[model samples]
Target: MISIAAFYIVVSVLAYVTYAIDKQAAIKQRRRVSEKSLHLLGLLGGWPGGLFAQQRLRHKTQKTTFQAIFWLTVAVNVACLLSLTLYPYGG
Candidate 1:
């Protein structure tokens, strides 16, 4: 459980940094991070950080398609987390 919490903390921090970098790139008209990579990070239990980044950096917040997929990844991540918590022994 401690390891899981630590994993989430690390991944979420990385996700937040990634979003910040992407936002800066967008502002500078530089190459952007792939949407797939962002979504992958969210699906890997970084959605909390992703949500923070979306609100703080104002990145990828208005695109309907991206928003839809982002929410889906959040849902999947939450469901997996719930399952792990409820069935810690893989019942």
Candidate 2:
């Protein structure tokens, strides 16, 4: 089994990569990071990074739907992380 630390590290890397891609897309005005990819990244615990990219790159911040979905994803991921930490293994 992968350790929690490893899992978070992977998530952070994914977040950074996705953020970079999204930023590039914005520079080219292409919107490369689709709604699907945004949702997927958020579900994977990368919403914070995604949100930062959105602000930093001035991308995808105006759509109400995107904001709603993104925040929901963040909440879900936070819930999952809290549960995982609060629950003991092999209980």
Leading candidate by lDDT: 1
What is the C-alpha lDDT profile of model 1 across 1-91, one tens digit per residue? 5588899989999999999999999999999999999999999988889999999989999999999999999999999999999999999
TM of each candidate vs. truth:
0.94, 0.74
**Model 2 lDDT per residue over 1-91, tens place:** 9987677667766876787887787788885867788788878877766777778767778889988998999999989888888885724
Instruction: Return the clash pairs for model 1, or none.
Output: none
Give all candidates' CA lDDT scores: 0.95, 0.78
On the 0 to 100 scale, the lDDT of residue 90 in model 1 is 100
The alpha-carbon lDDT assigned to residue 8 of candidate 2 equals 62
Question: So what's the TM-score on candidate 2?
Answer: 0.74
Worst 10 residues of 2 by lDDT: 7-16
Highest-scoring model, TM-score: 1
